[model samples]
Target: MKKINKLILMVMITATAVISSCQKLDMPPTNIFTPDIIFGSEAGVKSFLATIYRALPIEDFKYRPDQGFKVGANDWENFYNSASVTGEQVGPFGGMDIGGGFGYWPYKDIRNVNTLIEELPKYANKLGEAKVKSLLGEAHFLRAYFYFGLAKRYGGVPILTEVQDPGAPLESLQVHRDKEEATWDFIGAELDLGYQMMDETNETGRANKYVAAALKSRAMLYAGSIAKYGSVNFVDGLARAQGIVGIPADKANQYFTKAFDAAKLLDGHYSLYDKNSDKVQNYIDLFLKGDSPENIFIKQYSIVSGSAHSWDATMSPRYMTANALSRSYPTLDFVQRWGALSVTNTDGTPKRFNNRAELMEGLEPRLLATVYFPGATLRGLTFDMQRGIYPSFSGTAAAEVAKQPNTRSYILAGDTKTLYQGKMVIGFTGPWTGGDELTRTGFYVRKYVDAAKPIATVDLNRSEQPWIDLRYAEVLLNKAEAAMELGNASDALTAINLIRVRAGATVYNSIDIDKIRNERGMELAFENHYYWDLKRWRNADLVLNNTRFKGLMPYYVFSENKYIFLAEPELMQRNYNFDKRFYYEPIPGGELGKNPNLYPNNPNY
Candidate 1:
């Protein structure tokens, strides 16, 4: 069966708007569908629904910290994301300052969804009652999804349930922000409504009952964390009074229970994708294959319809990529946490490895799947990432030669001692700071890259890999985390072990909050969950205060015929001071200027 091409609908609708906007608003274009005409037909309603889907804040391939979601015609070079901010990974050149404010006020999208909800019922004659209600359910889900995005980032925002008139009094339009608790409750209620009204099966890329439940699972988990872990001390007097940013601690369990229950609803419907015999390959295949049972909700992309991303071009290693270079470099700090092959020895002591290769011998399969270390192969080529080789010398000469610059090239044992040979042999995947394409942290990203795409050619549109928005693995982790927080160890271990077993890791007999958090970090690295996870757990300030993320320098020793790894602070100075006030992003200055009612903005704005 052919895949449902939603991008075609999106293109048609966007084209219509572009043409209509170019002409005068007072005079309707010669041949165009106005808002009224568009909503009057069932096909037109689906077209509008396509627009709503396109505007979702999935934070997929186009997302960057500097620019928000779905950025078009922006420089792809400045592609740093939440992973960079959280110290899970560093950029190719150096560490980036996490200063860009998250100005994600999707009020416009919410308004569009509100307009759809208001109009869908009116066309019940043209579209059947069931179809109208399902569409309305999707609209509610979209609104809840947008509000949830806002509430997570900037606390409570104004909830506009119905479409407001442009000519209405400014005071009436300037709706007060709801309490953080109420906003979360509203999201949960809307998801419940969506789940009830949505069909069990619908068109691909559209939200069904399972999708609604998956969203509810994530939303409730965020709400539960905020209620339990967020600080009440930062609550501003005016903002608190206006119902903007504080949730009582007592309400934690209620939200956690909701998250757990919602997640439970998808128990048998989805399972971890473990089709490949090679565990590492299995983890990699999970992202490449579009029809995995683990994927609950996905944002589909189509190269044929001119809707695609540059993720492959932007993230592949320098040697592998065609135009853009690798941007996200996994950090040494994150790599160490992946843990050695065995956590403990038979005597219950921490396990240790004699050599660098031994250290990497039995790592959790997920770590290998997620990161491309020095010797990993990609697209049929091995990444020989040698910072510098240790020169072969006698006792006194060896000590002097060892003092040479580690970033410079040296002759290898098997190669000829010619100038050209030495230069060509070294720094294949560099730790050199002189260029834009070199890997400064001695690593390249492996996750979310399309290995099937042409690595040597710069074709952005051909990068049609689907972005998995809500995967069942995340839901399972969510269930485990909530269960752990609620002190249900049995349930927590049950959920977590399923993930561990799938990844070919040793299952835990006992687990703590730290174990769960680390597991989540390892499993979901570079998937855009760690940054928010740190914030919601209230550990961002402690973990990232005035710290420099670390990197590994792997150098091959010619005499020993083995590789040696040096773990040290990254060459570039990266000072990351996470101010407590950053827990809630400041309300956008433009929004505040438009409506002073959003006054007394989030603390420390």
Candidate 2:
């Protein structure tokens, strides 16, 4: 059998953390640090924990729906992100189907965390009992996190807590799947242990008592949702019979209670960021500011540390960025969910405006913060998003909706050089006649884009804004959803209104499940929550069933000398379809072959 020290080195080498590039760590020889050397001191233990934090399955900006968590640093696949799969945005790639995940099996990382939990107690004398317990609590939080990632994807994965010996018999090594209910119960229990054992505060990115509870608030909400809605997309299979892929609908309230209680524990610990009186700017700064009180937990990055992302370059308008233009454009369908845009008249004729930017007047400030309308400024450049020049139009707005390109009377500009009456027909930053790198929806994403970053410097691997994983807003949303589910409408209304008050939107006078859900969607838009929220609510299939998301097109009326916005199907006319079987991703085929006990796979694999 190999020495435990050898196994420790193997795990340490795979450690990746957001604090710094795992590859650029200035460390001595790996073989020098054994289990004793690693767990003996506070600094050594921190180094070990860094690796565990690095392995967390955070679906941040790097996550691609067609792929999985943590795409390659250089891969431009971040362009096709989770927002596109949902109705949040229409991207250049990846329609509705996100096939059987990216074969994510993190048991090896789980074992490393397990090894720390199992072995750390031996050095309690050197690192005081309180310190040891605290570290162990962090380890438990990590283990629960890894399992949560699996539970959300492939339901009821094997609950492997102990570090199993490799020399054990094959039958002992191959564990059978737990019931889906038991899996969520285990996750809650582990989080409870973390909540009880950890401290109230720690470093920004590190887990603490409140952070553990915050995760419980999020994770238990997911479990409660699965219990209530898992039957909506049920399939008759051995896995269902064994309780591997579906939860009992009867236990939904029990899980909702847990979610509500977990969320309540964080009531006084964090707050919604409200530094700026300007609601729009306050909302924008909430994501950008690292020191905001709203942040429960975040994944830190630094360009100097060589851990950076391409969000700014990929999301910025073509004219705003020097490299890598916009790929995903928000849909008008999603924009309308917040509230109706004032772009149509009472008779259904398209509303004509002297300035195209006036289309956003009297709209929610939160919506304005989330997206850049035609005249919104970024990096000193106004986003001039004009699609075509219509010489004349005598018909209603309904007639122009989703009309074929070649047949429309509107003279669409073929290129940037096309001129109508000595002025460029299409804006430099375009919803142009044809091409990528332009906003097809006549808008751009303003959320999370660093307005302070110089326009010329925006490129791949240049963005270093920290990804806020858990925030106080989400906790409140979770509490609100649970309260609504538990029939406490007053509490639900209060929680929902807190977010709305901060957002400068109209607060609800009454509450229901749909209202609670819509607030969650609007509040958490493009943070990569909508897709999962839809899945847990079992509404993805109904929402995306042959759905063709619409885009807002701005047309310059050449004869009238004004602009009119038209709601039209996106240029590609791509149809997004969601099969019901996608609710739970299929168990990885490789894992099933390795251990037959892991069968039967999820429905319709």
Candidate 3:
């Protein structure tokens, strides 16, 4: 209930003695709780803080990138996650529709945070000085988090540090947008204050000193990136001239240094999750294990609290779920980013494998752990990801790859239940063209799906996996990127190799910006970072220009009783297009209507 309700802290205390004594109402309502009553005790403060935490704008399991963040249970299409739009996965959707965001405006949430930071200090005597400062620090961290969310979507939003008085002149309450660099500076300053005032440790999922630092590491990296690359992809207009939608190129190193310094603060405070000796299992457990050392800040979910998501239900295959089935599938293009797949022979012919799972052999354990390749098992059932049965095959993979699915020489099955020669033509977890719930890319996301949960019983809103909002892995990536940009190649190499070692992949002896970017893409895949990463790096338009993500279609040859994988365009044939104008999302039309001062909107709306 706390997650759903905004705890305003004004409650009827029902002062019975006062009510009995007063025949006529001469004083303020006795039922009302004052700011002191709310901030004076730990319980009261925690209760109030719960609302702010609930509205923290984390794009977790429930976030639909094509939609906006935090649309919640109503987002039945959430499985079409941010990865879909970024070419990381091929979800059952068309082109880039979310270029203009779903209008995420969180100034109201910011005001609540401001209210806490402003009013809490008055009760310092009631709640000890240290406690009051810590609470205020938490408030600052929250405000920074909210601001970062805004800064990423629309460049420079109105920087409202103090809560605006509703009774004041309308002109006074109506604020104009701050310079993009100024907004980013404000976020950095808030996080700095947060780090200075907060203690080292706090409860899980709440902001501590290091949590603020972790956020700073991420936010400042975005700022640094925008400053460096913002000019590369520019939209000329009044907003650009006014410095409201873009950062100056000269400020790049300043922000990158800030990011680097902030990231360095988290070095020894936390370590990567390395519980298991088996790298693949260890990587898988990094997300599932609740007490992982790598998790810096996580938004927890509990079935008992009724605040759970449908990750397992939406990400797992149709055969593995009782209700909702898989909608998002990893693309071959994204999978190849980690390393080349062994799907083809030296002569460019499709490699014949004894089993579908053998395709995973010699691949990086991290990749295997991130995606459920064909023949991977969940609960007890194999993924069984066969696209269709090929009755006969005698050609190079290139020739086969050239032919369309319908035009190809394979026997297409209507569904998994369709049989050919007494054997199921399509696998249970399928690339069945007949249905939408089946796997379209021959892979299911393995990262956050709880294999411990029984697939026969898996359903929506029952998944209890906590969403790791900030992790040491991302901080390391931030460090690596910043270090590389700052020309500190050695530090960047060390940071990347640290992740590469844990991933069981070949450690790189050399580091470059592209390497760092690729490593970030591979490490933070499907965690809702790639899309934003592309935008900040000013690569979305170039990377996604008429791009159609490919899918690894595993076809079983009935004659040889062996599987041959073919890289082909995804079935939907959806083309991902990111225009230069989409580099900055348009400010929500409603916001502009409410406050004309918020214009001129970002580039082309």
lDDT of each: 0.71, 0.82, 0.82
**lDDT minimum window of 10 residues, candidate 1:** 18-27
Error of 3 at 39 (Å): 1.5
Q: Candidate 3 on 44-69: residue-level lDDT in tens?
A: 67656666676777888877666665
Per residue, candidate 1 scores C-alpha lDDT tens digits across 515-583 of: 888889888888889888877887788888777887776665565555555554664546666777778
Order of models, best lDDT first: 2, 3, 1
Q: Report the lDDT tens digits of candidate 2 across residue range 485-537.
A: 99989989999999999999998889999888888888898999998898888
Question: Evaluated with TM-score, which candidate comes out highest?
Answer: 2
Return the lDDT, model 2, position 363. Answer: 79
Q: Could you tell me how far off, in angstroms, the CA of residue 177 lies in candidate 1 after the best superposition?
A: 1.3
Question: Model 2, which residues run further than 4 Å from truth?
Answer: 1-3, 12-32, 71-76
Candidate closest to the true structure, highest lDDT: 2
Colliding pairs, model 2: 16-54
Better of 1 and 3 by lDDT: 3
